[model samples]
Target: MKRSIATLFILFSITIVKAQEIDSLSFIKSKRMSDDDLAKKREGTFFTGIPDFSSDPVTGFGFGLRTNTYWNGNRDNPLFPYTPYLAKLKANAAYYTSNARELVLSLDVPYYKGTRWRFKIDFKAQQNPANLYFGLTESTLGQLRLPSDENTTFSTYREFDRARKTLRPGGVGEADFVTDALSNRFRETEYMLNLKADYALGNGKWRIMGGYEIQHLSYTTFEGMEAEAIDPITGQNTTAPNGISLLRRDFEDGLISGVDGGWVSIIQTALIFDTRDFEPDPTKGYYFEIANEYSSKYIGSQFDFNKLFIQGRAYQKLPIGKRTVLAGRFGAGNIFGNNAPFFEFQDQWSPEGSINALGGRQSLRGYRANRFLARSMWFTNVELRVRLAETQIGKQRFAFAVAPFFDAGTVRDRWQDLNFKNIKTSYGGGLRIAWNQSTILSFDYGHSKEDRLFYFGIGQAF
Candidate 1:
């Protein structure tokens, strides 16, 4: 899986370079403008195109367009300082040459009313024609046993045969048992809307925040999984030979609750303490946030649950150079309810959706997305970031950085069941490019005992 993903990333890089050539003429035109025009473009609204190359286990190779509109709120309110009033609106659309498509639009207002308030809104719609799903648990590794012939029902016999074929050593079913296996092809459609407001308190060192979120999720079995298969005996209806059937049927049978999906509504509030000098790439300071979310029958949620989240991060500039810094983050989450939805149990969610707990590019870099999920989880990350170079192009400043990081985490069905000794660990290094002062592009590679993962995306991984 690592080798294939690396190769795909190389191909994606080459393709994006070619795609960026289409926008070179516009960039050159802007570079040739008068000094006053250039300064105006920098202070006012200016557009830039970024090469979009991303890959995941589910989305094989994705290439697309990301356009950013950057401007200063001070242009609209001269009383505000330009540094804190900088804002961005971004639109991203991409297609996985393999089997998926995604579109996202976001607005970030980091300094409303001169840093006294901050706001953000995001809208995303994605169609994953084929996505993978292992069972709902912390462990995907399982022992396989053949069924007994005596008094076995037909369903039981069929299940035994399916497992035998899928879980066999070095057989077609063997891939399912590997770290990359344990997957099914399903189509997912999701619509999410999030709104948050933060108010600064006591000389802007502390903040009070509130947010609301609504999400609609739908999933179905994708067709064409058996399109290439043929019956060996009768050459008709290649059903049993399809690998996806096993996993898809499990979902249909309610093996994991809420697989069909529905609506989820949540309201949350938090207290935050932040002293970071800069927001985009913090240099020296500490940030701590503790929050709670509630979903109830009165909130128009399909499930009733209460969730608690706490996260803290600290950054310190190294003595070696002003550009070198060490950062560490710790986070934990727990869900409480009679029967919470399995999807909500994922480690990606917090009071602030931007924070990640245990998986994906932002959290445990080596594991697959949502690879480990449970009722409760805790994770920590440490990284050393060194800025290597800085350059200016067409009134924009860019900084290149290298970061080496370590990550570890664990999850269990219940809080008491948590075993610190069973933690999963990964280590990796990454490259980053910061545009202007805020926007960031990152490429990272991570490795663990199970597999390796490569990620390319925007923003700092905190």
Candidate 2:
């Protein structure tokens, strides 16, 4: 898998170089065109298509297509300015062969009607036929009891070793035992609809935002697995009764029995202050936001929770070069009310919808999605982006960049228990490609104490 990923990256780099060369030759050939002709050709919608390649522990290497369309909503009104009121639509879909499938569609209408208001709507549907789970909370390792006794605390690697050492008298070894006993992989289907509106304040640097979200989530265990049981007398592993599965055992143990599948309706509001020069790839300025969310039976929600979130980001253009920039973000979230649903603990439900509490590609890139969950969490990310190249292909503009970043975060069962030493950290670098300053393609590689991960996605992590 590593070799394949390396080869794919090499091919991608070669393709980028070739495309630059081709653009250069095309520019030379177009020198005969008058400036007026070039200006006349630039007044239409621009479309960009890019091949997507992404991999993670959950979905392996997946290939797909991502398409973006950008146009000025005031295209017909020649007197109107071109930017700050632009419209964008994005559609992306990916399939991990036999592993998983995802589709996302979103539209953004900024500065509608020359007013301060902006609107955005997004719909996402995903089917993960086999998604991984490492139990829940701090009990995941203790529940396995593989590498040592129930009370022993050891690294994940050590746990695997212990599992091997204690293979049942006639049972499978550690690897196979973990794969069977802890298949942890299950099928999950999720559909989300998000709608948001923002109204700018006095200077257009601050804004008030409101949004509603409807989510439907369901899960089922993967098939074709033999259930395991422990022999009461010998402590050996053996096959369980017919119709039993690892997922069933978890349900019987009451791990995720609550809030497994349900409808979650959320109403959210936020106050935002943004001075960034560009939304997709900000060069300079500060962005800060505070948000509140309410979900309850009164609001047509199956579960109830009130969440408070706050986040801030800073982007500085370095004097080292025209293209060097430094960007950093800090954010935290806490859930209130009784019996918060496990699904709501996800990093996606907070202020701006872009900032995650922790884990996943958006926050801790080296960790798995929803790797950590608690009532409250905080995270920070810093990156230094350096532009490697910029050029024009036909009438479209393109820029390539490389960014090295650091991420650290931690989750706590209670807000007051937050501690810095518990923070999980990761360091990584990323490759970014921008088109027309509106659309971005990203490839990042991150390493953490537990694992190393590679992710390919759209837009900035923050």
Write down the TM-score of every candidate: 0.75, 0.77
lDDT of each: 0.63, 0.66
Give the Å shift of residue 208 in candidate 2: 1.1
The alpha-carbon deviation from the true structure for residue 263 of candidate 1, after best TM-score superposition, in angstroms, is: 1.7
| Clashing residue pairs in candidate 2 (N, C-alpha, C atoms within 3 angstroms) | 147-162
Clashes of 1: 1
lDDT of 2 by residue, 1-462 (tens): 312322343354344334432111221121122232223333457787887786665577888998988774433553122243267788999988646899999898876755556899999999986554544453331323332133544455334433433323322222233223334456779899999887655556666677788989897763334545455457676663222234455566675444367888887777778776566677677888877777778778887777777889998878876578899998887877656665566654544455544566889887766666667788899999999888887778778999999999887777887678567888999999877666777889988766678888778886
**Evaluated with TM-score, which candidate comes out highest?**
2
What is the per-residue lDDT of model 1 for residues 1-462, given as tens digits with 9 covering 90 to 100?
312322343354344334432211221121122232223324556676776787765467789998888765434454222232357788999999656888899887764644456788888988876554444555432222222112322222234334333322223432222211223445678888888776655445666677788989887653223233333345443332233343455555675566668998977666778776555677677888877677766879887777777899998888775488899988877777756766666544543455544566877887666656677788899999999988788688888999999999887767777668688888999998988756778888888766578888877887
- Model 2 lDDT, full chain set: 0.66
Which TM-score value belongs to model 2?
A: 0.77
